[model samples]
Target: MSVTQQRFMRRGVTKFLFLKAIADAGNVPLRPELASANATDLSGAISDVAGWSLANSPIDTPDMGSPMTTNIPGEDKADSSSLTFYEDLAAETIETLLTKGVVGFVVIMRKGDVPASKSMDIFPVRVAGRAPAYSAGSDPAKFTVTFAISGEPTLDAAIPASS
Candidate 1:
């Protein structure tokens, strides 16, 4: 019997882009356009990223006739996500652009920057807050920006060929 090879992926290959010009009125840029010069590539500045998942809330349904209580999945919602970046005071950096109340789209390419092959997640978000994380020791200065998902996200969408 012949065995098939299974390969695993690494998180280091992921790419994060912040598109500040995208409006909050349900406007989603085409997949190909996400890699354009307009989008800010935040991969170099970011140190960590967390929570961009859509989770379901379970609703309990208890009936009078049944001995056991039943539950069903309720509305799906994307939880508040955050991105930690190495603080940059230079002009037009992410720390300056991701101020409070800023609205934009966060494009995450999980399978690398290959066009027309890998998939990505598009999140319409509003900047909830941005706070600095100062350390007393030898650690580098960083800041975390929280985002509230403003609209429905495009999950696992295919990346189109670059124009």
Candidate 2:
């Protein structure tokens, strides 16, 4: 097997990753205009750091050691992902949050050499909280947007062809 094939972990590129917001609550459509180059555009999306985590906790039974511990399936948990970017205060961007019209977020991890199959698409995340900060002490203004995974997230081994 190739060295790349034997590897279990693949390093993601931050530049290739993007965070998108859909005004409507539904499946995300992979449109050509949603590319990262047009991130500032209304049809495009924001930015995100790669390699965010997805995890779940398991219910356990006490005093079940010697042989094996019993673990019941608990609720699926998601670590909130935070995206930091400079605030341009664009009308479309500000309106999406101020008007509360955004429905969900999509994190797109573009495919690379390590993962030759396809890209990774994480979506349908709800906006849990957002903090748009401004400073007058020589520092630039930025926004920190946090999101919570809502319902069942579409996490696939490979990017879906229909996306």
Question: What's the residue-level lDDT of 122 in candidate 2?
Answer: 51
Model 1 clash tally?
0
lDDT of 1 by residue, 30-114 (tens): 6545756668888888888889889999999999999899999999999779999997666547766788998988988878776
Q: CA lDDT of 24 in candidate 2?
A: 29
Q: How many times do residue backbones clash in model 2?
A: 0
For candidate 1, what is the lDDT? 0.81
TM-score of each: 0.83, 0.57
Per residue, candidate 2 scores C-alpha lDDT tens digits across 135-158 of: 779866666666566655555434
Q: lDDT (CA) for every model shown?
A: 0.81, 0.49
Error of 2 at 13 (Å): 4.2
